[model samples]
Target: MRAAIAGSDAVRGTTSPNPPVGCVILDAEGNQVGLGATQPPGGSHAEVMALVDAGTKARGGTAVVTLEPCAHHGRTPPCTRALIAAGVKKVVFAVADPNPAAAGGRTVLTDAGVTVESGLLADEVELGPLRAWLHYARTGRPHVTWKYAATLDGRVAAADGTSRWISSEESRAQVHDLRRRIDAIVAGRGTILADDSALTARSADGTADGTSVDRQPLRVVVGTGDLPEGARVLDDAAETLHLRTREPSEVLAALGERGVVDVLLEGGPTLAGAFVQAGAVDRVLAYVAPTLLGDGPVALGASGVSTITGAHRFRVEGVTMCGPDVRISAVPDRN
Candidate 1:
């Protein structure tokens, strides 16, 4: 299970909206026969790749996959059919499909006389692979992961608003890769005006056209305020999606209806806080640098809690170092 889940990290930035899954097939002697991962939305599925690698060796073997085999056909054939054809005799998994069409993989396998066991390291497996999908299934909108850069003391910028290079080049490249996976990237009016961010989903080859290929994530800005005339997002008039909403749920719901399944919020403090306070934030990814900027914009919007005694709590999900900075992620307690 650990190996299956670990394989998901290799394709994080490209899998957006789609949950990343990993699979491993082992023969009777417990020697690995095949290994694979979910490619993209409509590409080869994890089990197909693993079965392909396993080939004829898959017969009578055990297949351990991080997520349940998908039961229905969509971009690819149903994975249950692949496993059965490959002759995998037993299956073990960490999660079940919540999608209506995919809800009965284990049932189908059981009816076919295959043994199945589930929930081995389920939480960790889900976090690594099914995070975006689970978040979307629960809220009916794209999973929103608010990404930001801040000082060690949690300042996003100085009092003068001269924020630059909070993290290293390596980290910025990593962020861009994140840009490619999601259906859209959003910013507040302030970020759009101040940064003049293109808000386009850029990749190594070129920028998304917002039409042909996933519609370029619908470049979005939230505001009632006006943006500068020369801003890049404004320059491409037909390409931008502007939402004038004071409420988070209203805007998110509209986006969800359009098939947007994941959103990366690279917006300003007020907007980020609005999302968090509204219980709209699904994940928080912050890059904390080593220096302290003191009285600048804090990592989050200012709220009066009167001390540590008064606070809204969230759980730390994971932490990793990017160049000289540390990235911290958290999820709200569903309990």
Candidate 2:
């Protein structure tokens, strides 16, 4: 199951609308035979790929998958049918398929006399690779992760408005890797005007030369202001979209229409505050440097929290050291 989860994580950015599932096949003697992850859209699912890899070895074998094998026919045939045809005898899955159309795979397998078991490392799978997709399935919107880097005093920029290189090199590399795994990178027009950021996910070693990776997430700029013709985001590094709207929900809706499942909000403090005020932020990824800047722009602008009771609180999910910086992951605390 852990291997399956890792496989799922490996292909997170490629599959959208379709869950990025992972599967491993073990022969009758319990020796691992094959492993695979979901392909891009309109491609074979994870089980089919793994079965193809297993070939004749799949007969009477056990299949361990990150997500329940989908049982419905969408872009391709149902995965349950493929598993049955592969002659797999037992299936162990971490998380059940949440889509109404994709659910009931266990039943299908059981009806075919295949042993089916679920909830093996379910929480890990759900909270790890499946987190954004599950949220998109339950809600008809993209999952938003607001990302920001600031000093220990919560200052995103210095007093002179210079905000370059706040986080350590390791943290920046992690951010670039994260940018490669999501559907889109969202920022406001103000950020584009001020930073002139390319917003492209570049190779870890090519950051100095500005060489982008093979797969770059969609760059989305939101706001009514006009972007300069020479803006770096307008280059050919990746696809760029000008939303021409300041509403966070509207931006998300537009991206959702484009089949975006995960979003990294990289906008400035004002834009971040707007999303916060609209209650649209789903997760928060903060990178805090050890240094402190007493006078500078904070991480967030006016967020409509007039009273202390109205503060938007969040539960810290994790804290880790990224070189000299501290990285924190948190989600909103609605309770």
Candidate 3:
């Protein structure tokens, strides 16, 4: 199962709207025979690929997969059918299929005389590479990860609004790597007017590594303000969407319908405040610099929490040092 999870991680960015699944095949003697991962959208599923790699060795063998074999047919045939026809003796899976149309794979396999075992390293599989798609399937909304950089005193910009390079170059590079994984990158019209950021997933030197990124994420601008004709986000590097709304739920719902599983929110303070106040933010990626700006704009605008009792709490998931800056990752504490 661990090997299966590793296979899932290898193709994370390319399989949006579909979980990046992994599979490993073992012969009757329990020796690993083949390994496979989900291909890009409309390509072969992980199980089929593994079966093909195993060939005759797949008959009477056990299959270990990160996600349950898909039971329904969409762009391809049902994975359960494939496994049954391949004469697999048993199946072990990590996570259950959350889609209603694709559920019940376990029943299908069990009824076909194949032993089925579930929840093997399930937490690791669900929270690791499949986190975004599982969240989207359960909530019917894209998982939003709000990312920002601020000073030691929590200032995003200086008092004069000249916010340039608050965090180190290393932290900025990490953001580009993150941008390559998500389905869309969103900002407000205010940010577009102020920074005119290109928002493409590129290195600090402004070059896209074609080998890793076949397509750039969708660039999105939200708000009622009109954008200039030559906004950098409107460049032909990638398709751009102007939502013309300030509500976070509306933006997420629209993106969800478009098959967007994850969203990277690069919006400004006011827009970030709206998402926070609306409880739309699922995760937070904050980079804290060592410098202090006593009087300047904070990282987020008013979130309507007047007192400490009403404060939004987050549980720290990780803390790391990126050059001279500290990168903190957290998720909302809903307890």
Candidate 4:
């Protein structure tokens, strides 16, 4: 199951509207025979690839997968049918498919006399690769992770408004990697006017690798503010969306209509405050540098919280060192 989870990570960003699944095939003697991960949209599913690799070894073998095999047919036949025909005697999966259109694989396999078990390492799968897609399934909107880099004292910039180099070079590289895994990256008009960022996911030196980025996430700018014609985001680096609205919910709704499942929110403090006040932010990624700015703009603006009890709160998910900085990941904890 752990190997299957790792395989799912291989194609994380490429598959949209489709969960990245992984599969492992074990012969009756309990020796692993095959392994496979999901491909892009309209491609063969993980189960099919593993079964093909297993060949004759698949007969009477146990198939372990990260997600429950899909039951209904769309671009391809149902994965349940493929597993049955492969003579697989047993199937084990981590998480149940939540998408209503492609669920119920467990019942289908059981009806076909194939033993099926689920919920093996379900928490790990939910909190890891499946986090974004599952959120989309549960809510009719994209999962948003607000990302920001600031100094140790919660300052985003210096008193002179020179905000460059708050975090280390390693932290910036990590942000680029995060951008590559999501469907979109959004910034407010203030950020666009201040930085004019292109928001393209690339290597540290700002050069495209030519292969990994077959498709780049949509670069989005929010608010009714006009941008200069020479803005880097206006170039042909990737597709850009200029949403003339200040409402975070409206922005997410528009992206959802375009089949966006995950979004990296890179907006400024004002925009972040709006999202936080409206309860639209699902996760937060904060990079804290070792330096401190005595007087500067804060990492977040007012979020309608005037008292301690009403303050925005998040549960810490992870904390790690990124070169000379610290990266903290947290999720909304309303309770």
Candidate 5:
């Protein structure tokens, strides 16, 4: 199941705007029979592709999938029907679908007398194919990741405004890796004005790699403010939107309405403060340089969540050292 589930990560960057999905099939003897993962956009689903490969053998077997087999019709016919036709005796799933049209697919199966189970590999499934979709289901919004590269002391740039690379090549490559999975990347006026970034998800080769080509994420700059004369961000503004505003939640809501399933925030401290304070930052990825800048800057500044009760608190999730840079990740505490 873990090997089958891990396959979903390959399709995450391509599946976004669409949901991430994965599938596995078992033989009557309960041995692994066939497996398929969603390919880039316009590719066949894991179940459909697996069934295609499994042929007549899929009958009388169990299908283990990361998500509830989608019931409502879309690019393909309902998965529940497909599984039934394939004679999959049982279905095991990690998470329930929240789409109103497809929400009851599991019930449909169980009612048909097929052995159905939910939440079997829920955590692993979430970390795999259903990750982004599960995030949307839980919060009515996609999982948001805020990333920043700060100086030795954590300053993004000196108050004097000399902003070049703070972290090493390894750390920068890691940032590009994060860019691949997100539906879009956001920044405030200050970030755009100071650093004109070409926020596209480029490969380590510095060339465009568009597996799910049309999945090009909207490059969002949040402000109607004029940009520098030769600002790179403005050059690509046609693929983005600039909304002058102070309300972070409103901006997030607007983006959500536009089919932005997930967002990556590449910013300095101010916007991070706003997002974290609003209870909007689901995760923080910070890359800390080993050297010290004395009083330069830090990854996080003063948070803006109201009162101690409203403060943004996180439980450390991971710590990784890449060269001289130490990467730390934190998740919002449910409490």
Candidate 6:
């Protein structure tokens, strides 16, 4: 199950809207035969790929999968049919499919005389690779993670607005890795005009030259404004979309239409505040440096909170150190 979960995490950014599932096949003697992860949209799912890898060895074998094998047909045939045809004897899955159209895989497999077991390492799979997709499936919207970097005093930049290198090199590299694992990276017009960031996921060593990695997330610019000519974001590094609106919900709706299940919100404070005020941000990833800059803009702005009681509260999920910076992960305390 852990191997299956790792396989699912390996292909996070490629599969959006569809859950990035993982599967492993063990022969009748309980020896590992094959392993595979979900491919891109409209492609074969994890189980089919693993079955293909196993070939004749899949007969009378057990299949370990991260998600319940999909029962309904969409872009491809039902995974349950593939498993039955493959002659898989037993199925062990970590998480159940929440989408009604894709549920009931266990029942179908059981009726076919295949042993089915679920909830093996369910918590690990849910909190790791399946977190964003599950949230999207339950809410019918893209899951938003608002990421920012600031000083100890809560300032994003110095007094003169010349902001650069607020976090350590380790933190920046970690953010690049995170960008590569999400569906889209969203920034506001203000951020583009101020920083002219390419928003492309780059190799850690290539960060200085703006060289993009092979698989880059979609670059989404929000707000109704004309981008400057020859902007780096307009280059052929990755796909770019300029959304002509400042409404957070509108932006999310458009991205959702494009099959974006997870979104990384890297916009400026105003844009972040807008999303927070709209209750659109689902997670928060903040990097705080040790230095103090008391005279610049804070990490967030005007989030519709006029009093202490109205404050947008969040529960800290984790705190870790990245070089000299402190990384904090949290989610809204809607409870």
C-alpha TM-score for every candidate: 0.81, 0.97, 0.94, 0.95, 0.86, 0.97
Per lDDT, what order, best first?
Answer: 6, 2, 3, 4, 1, 5
Clashes of each: 3, 0, 0, 0, 4, 0
Mind sharing the TM-score for model 4? 0.95
List where candidate 4 sits over 4 angstroms from the true fold: 206-215
Segments of candidate 1 deviating more than 4 angstroms = 13-17, 169-174, 200-218, 224-230, 234-240, 302-310, 319-323
5 or 6, greater by lDDT: 6
Worst 10 residues of 3 by lDDT: 204-213
lDDT of 2 by residue, 1-335 (tens): 88889999999989997778899999999988989999999999999999999999999999999999988999999999999999999999998887898998999999999999999999998889999999998898899999999999999999999987888888888998999899999998898998898998875443633544568899999989789998999998799999999888899899899899999999799999999999889999999999988998998988999999889999999999999999999999978
* The candidate that achieves the highest lDDT relative to the unseen native structure: 6
- Across 1-335, the per-residue lDDT of candidate 5 in tens digits comes to 67557766666766655576777788899877788777655666777877776778899998888778877777767788888988889998877887786778888798777899889878877755666667777677767789887765767766666655678778877777777667788888777876677677765555566663334567887766766677776664237777677467887888878777778988657777778877788788888877655565555556765478766678888899977898998888886
Q: What is the lDDT, from 0 to 100, of the residue 36 in candidate 5?
A: 78
lDDT of 5: 0.75
Candidate 4 lDDT, 1-335, residue by residue in tens: 98889888777777777788889999999899989888778998899989998998999999999999999998989999999999999999999988888999999999999999889999999998888888998898889999999998999999998987788889988988888888899999888888777889987656776676566789999999787888989898888999999898899999999888889998799999999999889999999999978998997898999999898889999999999999999999967
**Model 1, range 1-335, lDDT digits (tens) per residue?**
77788776555545545667889999867889999888877788888988998989989998999888988888789999889888889999988877776769999899888899999889886676567767776657778889998888888888898886677766776776677656678789888877777876554234544453343456778988777778888765336778888468877987777666778898688888788777778888888889887777776674334588556677898899988989889887766
RMSD of every prediction: 4.4, 1.4, 1.7, 1.7, 3.1, 1.5
- Whole-model lDDT values for every prediction: 0.78, 0.91, 0.91, 0.89, 0.75, 0.92
Name the candidate, 4 or 5, with the larger lDDT value: 4
